[model samples]
Target: MSAELEGYEQDYAVLTAEITGRIGKVPRLVGDEKKLMILNVEKQLDEARELLEQMDLEVREIPVQSRSMYSNRMRSYKQEMSKLDTDFKRSRIAYSDEVRNELLGDDGNSSESQRAHLLDNTERLERSSRRLQAGYQVAVETEQIGQGILENLSQDREKIQRARERLRETDTNLGKSSRVLTGMLRRIIQNRVLVVILGIFIVFTIIMAIYFSIRRH
Candidate 1:
């Protein structure tokens, strides 16, 4: 890894950690303090984005073999950043809802009509909260499904690589067997030819012996 890439990574990590800490504090605070913390986190998130872009440029310049590992790390960092942003947004919304509820509470001095109006607003907030909860649940399920699909695809790629290696091994073994069969066939043909030559020599000798005996007689 280049020194520049390492520097960017370190900066990103620190920025994200700070952002996470600030987001955690947001819910515990209220009014101006909470709003200011939210703003600070948002600013840090933007800085994190810049750092990620710098890291991406560095990764592209690196060698191909090492690029993949860094690229994967970059993706992981982006995902973490996204989750942090989501958590921060959720905290901000929860804080807003908390403030709204406090405002809606009927002080004992509230008239009957005022109390009734507050009750109606409270009901609307509750309905909205329920809808938001339902949507968040669906989003979570969809993310899980997408993760599962990616895992399956990764497994399938490994299976294909293993199958290709096995095929290469099989081809190598077949090549050896073919050479062995060829050698055995050649040897069998040579042996047959030797046997035919020996038979012909024996027949010639027998005919020569018969002709010599008849001439002697």
Candidate 2:
């Protein structure tokens, strides 16, 4: 691999690692802090995408005999980037749900006043009940969405594992091919040396025969 491509791969690894670490911190954060972290992660993701594009270009310039390995690496990087993006989205949704729950909780003022007002008015109580029902429906939908995200994450993990296994297999095959080629090369060099030695021997024998014939004549 060329030096340029190797540098890009290193940069991509670092950037992705940073993004992953930041994403992990998001759930621990709240309010503006979480928002800022998410924005930063998004920007880093864009950079990561650009790096992948650069890597793809570099891989294309490589010779076909060696390009498959680099191409596979690129695919793995892309899959990782996709997984990171999905995790970021999930984090945002979780943060939103957390904030929503906080707001929906019974605080001292608003919730208490509503309860007192409901006691005095039947119509208001009915309205409050309907709102609660709608909130319950939203909660159910959110739970379903969260479940789907979990399933997708599991699938992505499997794909990454398969990709890793394929890469290892490719490396093993390349190693075997290298050893075979080296052995073939060694044999070819030895054959050439033997051929040169035989040629010289044949020439010397002819020279001796000619000299002997001249001396005898």
Best lDDT among the predictions, by candidate number? 2
TM-score of each: 0.47, 0.46
Candidate 2 regions off by >4 Å? 96-101, 106-217
- Give the lDDT of residue 79 in candidate 2: 64
Candidate number with greatest TM-score: 1
lDDT of 2 at 139: 64
| Each model's lDDT | 0.76, 0.77
Let me know the TM-score candidate 2 reaches against the reference structure: 0.46
Deviation from native of the Cα of residue 105 in model 2, angstroms: 1.7
Spell out the clash pairs found in candidate 1.
Answer: none
Mark the regions of model 1 whose C-alpha exceeds 4 Å error after superposition.
Answer: 1-110
RMSD of each: 9.5, 22.1
RMSD of 1: 9.5
